[model samples]
Target chain A: MLEKAIKGSKLYWGWIGLLLLGVATGFFAYTFQMKEGLSITGMSRDVSWGFYIAQFTFLVGVAASAVMMVIPKYLHHYQTFGRVLILGEFLAVAAVSMCLLFIVVDLGQPQRMLNVLLHPTPRSILFWDMIVLNGYLFLNILIGWVTLQAERKGVEPPKWIKPFIYLSIPWAVSIHTVTAFLYCGLPGRGFWLTAILAPRFLASAFASGPAFLILLCYIVKIFAKWDPGKEAIQSLAKIVTYAIITNLFFLSLEIFTVGYSQIPSHLLHFKYLFFGLEGHATYAPWMWVSVVAGLLAVLILLFPQNRKSDNVLAMACVLVFLSTWIDKGMGMISGGFVPNPLEEVVEYIPTKLELLITLGVYAAGFLILTILYKVAVGVKKEVDA
Target chain B: MRANRRKFLKIAGLATLGWSVFPNLLRASEGGEGAGHVRWGLAIDTKKLNDEVMEKAIVACHKNHNVPHIPDKREIKWLWKTTFHKAFPGQMLDNMHISEYAEKETLVLCNHCDNPPCVRVCPTKATFKRADGITMMDFHRCIGCRYCMAACPFGARSFNFYDPKKFLKSEEITTQFPTRTKGVVEKCLLCYERLDEGKKPYCVEAAEGVIYFGNLNDPESEIRKVLAERYAIKRKPELGTFPSVYYLI
Candidate 1:
């Protein structure tokens, strides 16, 4: 069985084919980015950030979702996540990889990314962001590799792996928290200037992250005949429901505080985001769509009957993920700069080159995640024996 | 006693080393780089800042800088015209709102603040304040973060949504400064480059006698002469961003 698994795995060729296609597309996009600079993407002065940042924000939530599985398996002694643990780790690896790519593509000079570390600015939040992102990426890699190695051996896992697993629980939270701080720490952007942004970020992250995981589990069950358990999905759905509620509650608090105060500066960005203030209605439609989608997603997750349906549950996760992405990533960052201190509305739209680069990065991340998961699945067959 | 003397010497030596390590700390608590150098401040005289002068100054500055006025109203503005009263929304002239001259506006641009908010918010240290109270951006280092835009209450920053240099007149085009790609923000630099050559700012030179061009620090400068003899005011002193541009009414 081990020899056959190594010689001709069912999923291995499919993974390799997809990976090659992704790499080719990514290379083409990268070449375009090099020639044209960042003008290819949509980003303007008033809306300095756009889709890439939104994607980064969304991926952080995905990365943090690893803790959903890790916490249950290790701390609560929930055996339901035993098979699903590798899936969570693989998702984290893909998500973090995407997060880094988004940031690189967003930069004006991608080569100068090293300067953030080499010429470290202790005063800048970006310096801390660099530290946290790289740290989180490495932590996930170490944990995933060690856990998988132990799982394959079928031993109770080494004692050292225990500490790393425990460490990952908090580290997962730290990644999203650090990402939140990146926006909240900025001074005058009224929408992002709240003390509750970190909590809100974590809440939303846990919600969408777990939703994606549950959906992924169901997907693999149908396609690969891998049944982690129905109990795990039900348990994860409950956690996700609560997380979504918290996310919405926090968002409401932000809106209420800003709206009730009637402060012009504080109200400006939100007004620009949700409802058009004057002629600047660019992101207003997207903002409203995200809000409506988010509310609907929560409702769907809240109902057990709807969550039981594989199609509805999967679709809810997809919508929830996208809605959160638009809200946290796109609107949040872009809206922060609108009605800029000078009261001028500078519009930022990402360029075509930027879009290509972004697509390339996504391909790279997906390719990595796919290959890693295939290897894990192949190795799982050996361990089960 | 010998031990005490050695300890005292050691303490003194450390103090000297500390001062040497932070060289700037050795300087007196002067507002600017050079001690006794008067910090420049602006006082706008709303009466003289009419639409004609505003247009003239803006056109001159734009022409000189090759700032493109993309016909799209939203995209237009290098040195645009804005109402003087609206510009200084916080302060009132003689306790009465300056509403009568609402139709006639003033030219507004970057206010080279003594403590600029834009400089404080820059993540990459791209936007910085010079020793002479000039807030400038190093376009090369700018990562298009737009934090400076959010921080600036003045709405002075602009992002290069496309290659802006492409809009330049054929003869006006130069490769001295890389045309900002889409993403990075750019704004008025107060023509610091032109100032280095002992030339008045393009706006001031083009304004003929409408706008004064001289150092505010030197009391003997034309700007100081105008302020000493005439009634002048700044846009928003209440914001605590001490601007270096003044207007004479």
Candidate 2:
């Protein structure tokens, strides 16, 4: 069915061409980083991780959000999701690929990345993260492909596939939880030490991942001329509304704890992110934008009329996507590092090369997403005819 | 079937014995002969540490280790200097007299925690805690993910963002120690190399009376004596890393 990706309209080829160009440029920047080291990036010794890890964190949430569709379709037997569930699984495949790519690009020794497997330490959260992410990527690919093949043939998926599909539901949660453990289990990082971090990650992931999927459904409707169905989209919008609200509620609880306890080590990180810490507020603007956009998204999504309208729902999903992107991608990792353990604020701003490499990874992910979606839609159209 | 069962029981018994005894044998061999008996520690007499004394110690350690002198935030230092308040942020008090202590420059380095978070978070065991309680790094094995840096509460770990050799002059390079490549995390190994050579760490040698280095497990060691007689405090002690380094305030 990959042949379906090859035989697309001029617009599809053009999009594929653009993505290839992005991959080429990112590879070019990466060679420079390899030669000169991580100096080409904006990370200092103070903020050891920058844009690459942040993007990895955000994309992990996106990957994990496939469960939102998986749970409703498999457990609840919601038939509306049957048409769109493959799209969600494919999105997870792409997102997990991006997550892995972001990690590789961020490494100072990308060449030695296999060492994580070779000299695996069971105690390291990163070690578990590697296991869970790869497991998730594999699960999504196997389930999405096998089930879609059965759909194209107009038969129920084989019995063996059922266990795998059910397993993916919890595996999705494990991927994000392990990613959170990569931060929360660390001793001195005051910002990430919260026990609620995994829950918060899941809530934000559910909101952003589904919101992005809703937008993708619209794109499929226009481009592929196959509606994923309005009922499916509306149900997703409701999921986004509840998830985003939960995300905001979790954020408030974190704030209340930090504010009431008044522990300077913990309080300082929030101060740096929300306000200026010692006159350096690099992320403050971005954080406020995330906060305002999240609240506005919730307000827009709350009403029944807004959910019914395609335009309003799209706007709200975009807001939800943007809001979570900034919160997780921009603030979360850097916030933990800044006002660093010693209480010194060293800012991180991604260099052009870093941003280019990041764009390359995103393009790579989209390229995968496009090809997968093309095959799924092509199969759907064939079966419908 | 009876012969096979007898053989399995013998093999299983040997395996259990090897599991228990081999670890002890391996631990004994790890930091050289009798290294399992030593838990190396440092006690810094901050009151005795002036700028000149601190500089000598920092310079000695850097010179011996071939640590580059990068003059920016990207600078690498196995040992360095900072203010008291910065070193111990959790200990700050709201009084003018206490604020004076905040301005006093104090020496800082890797605490080489007994329960190192860096060791716990390292994906590849590239950074590890030795039998002698010193945290060591194997640069060749590091994937440079920098998770150890995030785990270190002291901000002690430094990633080689650039090829470290570039910053060192030909004359400044120490042939005794290998210069690190870019993309690996490094920090004060607490002079494990010197300890192996039966010599004090270069910093201890340079600032003789100010910094005490000894085997903490030995009750009569100088570090233990210093701890007994002085009011020394370990940084972020509440976090339970149980840092091997202590500061005499």
Candidate 3:
């Protein structure tokens, strides 16, 4: 066992040590937040949501993006996807785990989380959010485990797993769409009060999430000496390019509506988010950066020459991922509350506890991804690919 | 100690679910134990709002209820004022130009909507509508999601940012209720506890009849009579929230 462990030295102990460090730091940070309340974080009344939730929202899309591999490999009988399908499933486990962790840290009282279960309100979008999040997590775990068991036994996957794999395609859409609904269904916050938000969420998720997975494929090639095939990478790049175009289109639709209507309440929110309304310029820089990065990513992916280059493709993927991470994950929710209910501009900065806890959560995700990918790589090496 | 702890837990648990599920059940179970049957509602005469009596009513309710005035102005609001035009955009007064009085009148607390959007959006069922048509927020169960604040159309909710006691005077602190911690949203409950004590709302009593407290359900009630007799209006009536609170123009 020790020899086996030594053989995969980079994947085993190094990954474990990183996870332990993250868990330890997160424990301390969570304890502090619990002792001092949410005030220990940078969130205020106007900006109630921040980094943790943004990360949660972004990661859910990444988790759902696993469907890209599952759909093609199983449904379409794409032989190319067979070699790397495990990577997507494992990445999903990591992403979903982090999504849950973000929600926990974002809660004012993490201990009382069961209150959601004890007193469920069907009328509330939040109640459904909990349901969808948990359901998605369980679905991924079940499918991933069943498929892996088949791989281990050198037998065909179970009959039931096919239905579930099929169900998860639309279910994957629902998880992120429901998340967008949690914001869009709100009555007064004009920032998210639109019919288009759900579609927008799916578009951006497809853009950034597949980009992340493709990057993971490249990373595996570099570190683990496994190639996910250039064809798969190119196909993913095509999906991302189209998704980015749609994502940008929806954002433009929002801008046009706000500008055309010229309603003070609606426009003020967009103004504050994009260009700094009434001297509230904190998020303005981030918004502009997101715009530039997003546009550049789309252009890079669309241009065959750019997408063909590994470095350029990797850079484009990183930029698009972060842009959506900022735009939808952080800025969308937070910007709604600025020029608050009372029309006053208030700033939100995450506290040290929040920052540390967020770092720990990211570390936890990295640890999971690293370990899972190792197992997947090892399993694949044994196969006659 | 164990028994007391158990009892407290039971009560707290029941209270948490009660307001969300069956608020009216308590009134029926408790056998209407007040000064006769009362379906409480408030009537504000904005013209009289500037009167010292009305201001005293606001202050009286604030003091009796231990409502904190956290000096960080953005976070501070239990009772305050706003122009009619500012509060309701589309509604037009008959004599807009000549009557400068309409501009100066102080708009008090939430209208206490019969169909509250705040209650609809709360994830933990922390803010629920009482059977008596009062929208009350339970600070203990609130997860500080702020979805309630986002859902409220009237902009009545205020979140406590810093510890409220830091900004309040010692005398301002009352034993009847605990001051809120940072995070959870809070707003006026229309002195429901005071109404339970066989007394008019502190606001009404202090206002010396400037603020009328009565059963809006009963046609013979003071508020109903006032609504019928005077030209009265509710804020943002178009939204169809059907607020029990009425203001005499």
Candidate with best lDDT: 2
Candidate 2: tens digits of C-alpha lDDT, residues A64-134: 99999999999999999998999999999999999999999999999999999798789999999999999
Chain A superposition TM-score per model: 0.92, 0.99, 0.94
Ranking by DockQ: 2, 3, 1
Candidate number with greatest DockQ? 2
Fnat per candidate: 0.28, 0.93, 0.47
Q: Model 1 over residues B1-249: C-alpha lDDT tens digits?
A: 999999999999999998899867766453433523644344445566666776777877776666776554225255667764456543433345554654446777777888787776566778887766668888777776655665665667777655665566767754443445544677877777776555667777777777776667888976788888997766566667777877676
Q: Taking the candidates one at a time, how many backbone clashes does each contain? A: 27, 0, 2
Highest TM-score model number: 2
* Ranked by lDDT, top first: 2, 3, 1
RMSD (CA, Å), each prediction: 6.9, 4.7, 6.0
- lDDT of the candidates, in the order given: 0.73, 0.93, 0.77
Question: Candidate 1 or 2, higher TM-score?
Answer: 2
Q: Each model's DockQ?
A: 0.25, 0.75, 0.38
Candidate 3 per-residue C-alpha lDDT over A288-353 given as tens digits, one digit per residue, 9 for 90 to 100: 889999998887888999999989999999989978888976687778777765566787666678
lDDT accuracy of residue A10 in candidate 2: 92
- Model 2 TM-score is 0.95
- Per-residue CA lDDT of model 1 for A13-126, tens digit only, reads 676667678667767876765665544555544455777887888888888888988888899899988877888888898999899888876666666566555555666666
TM-score of each: 0.81, 0.95, 0.87
- Model 3, residue pairs in steric clash: A42-A349, A42-A351
